[model samples]
Target: MTNISGALVSLALVIGIGIWGYKLLVRDVSGIPVVRAASGEMRVRPEEPGGELARHQGLSVNAVAAEGVAAKPADRLILAPKPLDLTEDDHVTPAAMVATAQQDQAAPAPVDQTEIAEALETGNVEELVAQLTAGVAPIAETEAEVEKVVATVAETVAAEVSAAERQVAALLDAPGVRHSVRPRIRPAIPAEVTQAALTAETPQSVEVDPASLPAGTRLAQLGAFDSPEVARQQWDQLMTRFDAYLADKKRIVQEARSGGRTFYRLRAMGFEDIADARRFCSALVAENQDCIPVVTR
Candidate 1:
């Protein structure tokens, strides 16, 4: 009997605790409550927390609201409007603006075309040349004009050249100017004979025996004359003319066989010095005009 009574008390305690917990979990709070409407219906008034219902007033809730939903005011701040009269005086009229643009678009004043054409056609070259020379402007521009200027210069030059040429020609053509004509004489030996002779240490003076003291040195044999008698006659004529001064002179006769003829030669003998001999020879040369200096070994 006592064990049955303990079991009945424990079951009553468990049932009372479960009922209190169910009431506490479903309770409303103290705030504005959220409302949920049906699919195509609108909410008239949202329920308040703590089971208090509020009137709808004029709020327009959209028909698509979910269960227990409500609308609230936005959190953004609003800006104030600016006054329009502050900038009212800065506007321009449309007509006045169009007239100002037209003035800017108009073409500039035209240049004088005739003056420009004249300036381009007659450039400043003549004016520049005139300024450089400090002279009057030139008017002519023809080939004849240029040729006339050239001819004037040429005439002046020709006059001076002709005067100089006449003076030179007169000097060249003067009379009685005894110009000497030296004959071309070839040595018996080769052309290098003179060079060899200069280096040969051979005596420059003629060789003679003292017995022929005033009887000149034998230079060279001149070869045979035309005839021995004719040669003797020529020598006697020379002796007759200068024998007084040539008394102590010597002569040289060279004989060679040419065409099988024998010839004799006679020349003036005895000159004390070569200068004396040359002077005598030169005098003879002036008179007879045929003698020359002879070289011999």
Candidate 2:
């Protein structure tokens, strides 16, 4: 019976201890405030010292309650360490200095925008030309170089003339069929007739071929020459003057008789039409040259 009473006392003590623990743990301690850090961790308010270590942390007690969370009036503040000041001991390498110098050298100098704007407004082309040719050398043909070139050209011409003379001498010395060839015979016209031909000023009417008198039959008459030599000289002058127009064109110096007077007529032949002949004459007349387009009969 004594053993049963001891067992009952032990059971009652255990029940009383469990009830006290439930009251302490399960009961709401609404008065006690809890702090929350920025990290979302719950911490005891600085005023509530749960341990000796918490009280020694020298935390402030005055706090503001915000949304059921205690906020510290002044929490423990931390600051980053200040950077050390530079000294002569901080050395820069030679390569780094060289690279910096190169970068500075490679960078273009600052331009004065105001000066540029003023120059542009004033139309200062001389300044622009000076800038463009600042470092460029002028290209000039020196007098000595020109003289040397002329000398070279003269020597070449002399050599060619010498060669031509030697060739002509050789041909004259050579026995050939040309040496035995006779000169062409000229028509025997009376001196009076020739004089009249030379003085003739009027245009002559001449008969032409029917085939040559097609729809576009026109002749470009230059002049009536007294002699073939004079006609040839005039023809050469015309060839030089109208080289482009006369390319592949026929030049003729024909002897025509009118009223017992014979004269050599210089003409540019084979014109396709009167329009073409007129055009050639118009161009010549524009250049102060006299030319006539004769309609073929």
Candidate 3:
């Protein structure tokens, strides 16, 4: 048992010496150091309890110090900015308000209905010029604008005038309204009057010879007979009596056969000197109801 105790004591002394050597090697001597993360941030770790050397050296310490200084500057800049402050008195003043009210009251009212209608109908440039001279503010901004409006109005008026003139001219030139006049003169005498004068100058007498007329002229047969002997016998009896009536103005000029029958005709005295044969034939027709008078050529 005494030998086992001596061995355990020696083992304990060796483990204690080994632990002291490790603490002497790892303990920080100068200062606790900082380290940089992969994202370029600085961070601190606790120093080893019994170390001899520092872990973070010059480059790592300088980088952490720069990050801390940059963070401090950003915070100071954030704290330095301030919002602007304004009071109610910094807005509009009483004098400016009064001036604006006065300007609103001084402005002209809208144009009357009668004036607007007259302006459209007349399109008078002289009236517009008068308005400008009277200091109507809105319309008379510049000479160019006024002239442009006047030119537009004048063009409309000119077109209307031209259209009316064309309508009037067309009406005057219409076919029914326009007429052509021609003169007619009458002659001293007409052709019909000359014809009448010539007819009056001619002779009115007509000469007829009874012997040249047809044999049946004096005794016209009333109807047809079946036999020529019957017709001739009837004609002879009528002529024998007719001869006595005609003896005072005429004589028997000839006897002829016509239409398969015989007839005797009497020739009158001169009708050129006196119209006795026509008068006798007229008398014979008047006296004998069955007789008809026929004048020969």
Candidate 4:
């Protein structure tokens, strides 16, 4: 009976120790300052701003990091740009700007629009040409007189040509004349020469002397003068200018009249034949000197 009581006492002590050990391990575990894990590390409940407990509760570290990235320069929020201050005291008006621009630019020279307007209004070709060339004004009476003289010269030339043709016909009919003889043919005059003869002389007032030219002379006519004296003077000038061509050659101032208007032709005489005279005239033309072949008979 003693032994049995001793065993029961021992069992009660063991039960008491087990109950105390369970209470110390579970109920008072929060009271412990630190708990060592298998790796000898102290287990801790993280209480940082972005802790595991906070992350699991929806405030994650990734979300906070994303917010930080947005705060950087790439995603920095910018304030609205300010509008232009148009009404400042230093601002310029459109009128003032235009006036300033005008002051900076140079004014153009004034033109004589009256001359152009007059040229357009009158429609007189000679007057317009005179104005353009700044030459002497043309006289209507002088032009009419010149035209009459030209007509007379043309008639005289026609008469001479007809006389020549008649002479040729007469020669062909003569018993003494050779049946096989070919008549001399005149060369065609160039348009340049015809145009020059029509309107090349410069207007000059001078006295005239009427005298006939030497017959059967093949000459080159350079120009016509108002007076025989002027023609002689022009010949002297031309001789001095073209001494090589005029050397050993004779010059004559021949008189011609038509419609009571006298004209003195300046002629270079002493060509061998009509062909020679025409060739010399061509040479003169090449030298910018106007000349026309003339047959005196």
Candidate 5:
């Protein structure tokens, strides 16, 4: 009897769903353009063409010009403000926080060097020490408590180590613990570079002064390589590829080391300051090349 009742309920649900779906799919409002289009009663309005169609539309758009009623260009400008004759040469890019321009700077971190010095000069060791150590009070000098503290720390460490040893032994004796040890890891060899690079003495990196170069001069680094020869080769290839932009630039190779491996950086000099160098890098980047603007003092 329960199964028959459930079947009746399911049949009623199916009938209700069919009726709702029929109304949703078949019933439509006449106001909607999509419904009107489906009934083949909608009209497609063509866009107004400014050419021959304008004449056929019963109005000559150029009737004033056809009747020789056109005004002079100067007469039109008489009512409007005179425009300035600007060229590409008049445009200039702003230096947006590139380290060299000294633009868009945040507040600097505060220091108390003078205050600390004054305290030290006045022989106020306590105040100086407190400031230097971030308010950590010094141990009292009246009693010999260092030995006692050391002894307590040593005893606590010994107890902890003994407990750790016992736990480690228990873990080692368990069936899941492996007795064998893996070999120690060795350092992998560095990447191989050009033959000349082996004997070539790498130049030490030194900070260059911005004023050291002629006025309106900046430097740019193009790539980093495993050796000086590779860096030089990259510079040569770049000169050939981007001769139009880099014709006046001089080649520079800088040496740097990291993790016991030496690297040489390829650079170009003779840009019209850091901005010019950045602009040059932007052009190179647009062509899928990597570039970095070198900062100087």
Candidate 6:
């Protein structure tokens, strides 16, 4: 707190000194007008007119003409009008007769009132309307030619589509890109040679019969399966996976039943006894295999 107060005091003193130096040494550069001592003739900034003039003449503006007069109430209220043009404007037959007086200077005798009413109200206004509209010529049907032109355009479009379809069909039905080219077929190998080559690549596995083992031979069961075929397939897969350990062992799919569930046991036969089966199963178990040693009764 003491250091802060000391620093603030020092800052205030520096600012005060700077302001004193500016006032004492520097001429006033602020926009406020300063009268110089050298100008001896100019006294006070030339005195402005004391108060506002007797009549203020402000900036000129575009104003409306002063000749327009206010309208009187009687003049503003619309009159009933001459009442003569009303009859002329309300009905058109009389006005059209008067307007076409030159054309009617020779024709149009006075029509009978009863005859006109009967002719006009005879279930349709056709005769009266026809008499009224006799002079006004109707606009002619110019669109017929336009419709004929549109029909011609549609026929042209259809013809173009058929031509395009024929062109595409011709392109598709043209001869093959490699028509004259012939393919060379490789000769087939003889069945005997194929068999020999296959035999050389993959030697045939020996099939073992469970009955051929000695009397006291024991079997190591790999797993119990639902069918003999599944057991055989499992044996093949296990032999493939553990070829080094189970290669010499013989596969046997033995069917078994407990109560109702009849299953086949995939067993490795050709073991001399339980001791050999146990050793074989121990080796498989060491490699994370499931094995059970069983004595074939």
lDDT of 5 by residue, 107-137 (tens): 4345478976788689987866655555333
Order by TM-score, highest first:
6, 5, 4, 2, 1, 3
lDDT of 2 at 212: 45
lDDT (Cα, 0-100) at 30 in candidate 5: 35
What RMSD does each model have against the real structure? 59.1, 47.1, 60.0, 55.8, 35.9, 35.9
**Model number with the top TM-score:** 6
Predictions in order: lDDT: 0.53, 0.67, 0.51, 0.68, 0.67, 0.68
lDDT score of model 6? Answer: 0.68
Residue 56 of model 1 has an lDDT of 68
Task: Kindly list the per-residue Cα lDDT of model 1 for residues 66-140, writing each as its tens digit.
Answer: 312233444666888986664656875333123223212333344456655665688955644443444332446
Clashing pairs in 6: none
Q: Stretches of candidate 3 above 4 Å error?
A: 28-97, 102-129, 134-297
Off by over 4 Å in 6: 1-205, 211-215
Prediction 5 global C-alpha lDDT: 0.67
Considering summed lDDT, which 10 consecutive residues are worst modelled in model 6? 59-68
Q: What is the C-alpha lDDT profile of model 6 across 16-102, one tens digit per residue?
A: 999998886655555477686774665565455575464533212211123122222343446686755557547654221232233
Better of 3 and 5 by lDDT: 5
User: Model 6: how far is 182 from its true place, Å?
Assistant: 67
lDDT of 4: 0.68
Q: How close is candidate 3 to the true structure, as a TM-score?
A: 0.17
Each prediction's TM-score versus the true structure? 0.23, 0.27, 0.17, 0.28, 0.29, 0.30
- Cα lDDT tens digits for candidate 3, 1-297: 999999999999999999997787777564468795587547665576576686655443454454432111232333656887778977664331232232232434545678766887898757755654454546455577557666776776788789999998998888784656755556545557444434322222222444565543443222244454554444445445564543333322334568888664433332332244444455455445243333433
Q: Candidate 2 clashing pairs?
A: none
| Model 2 C-alpha lDDT per residue in residues 1-297, reported as the tens digit of each score | 899999999999999999998788766664476796586657656664664553424333322122222333555578999999878768663331232232122333445678778889999968865664554434463466456666776776788789999999988888865466676666555455444346322222123333444454577888998897898778777777776766655666667889999898877766878888988887776566778998755
Worst lDDT 10-window in candidate 2 = 96-105
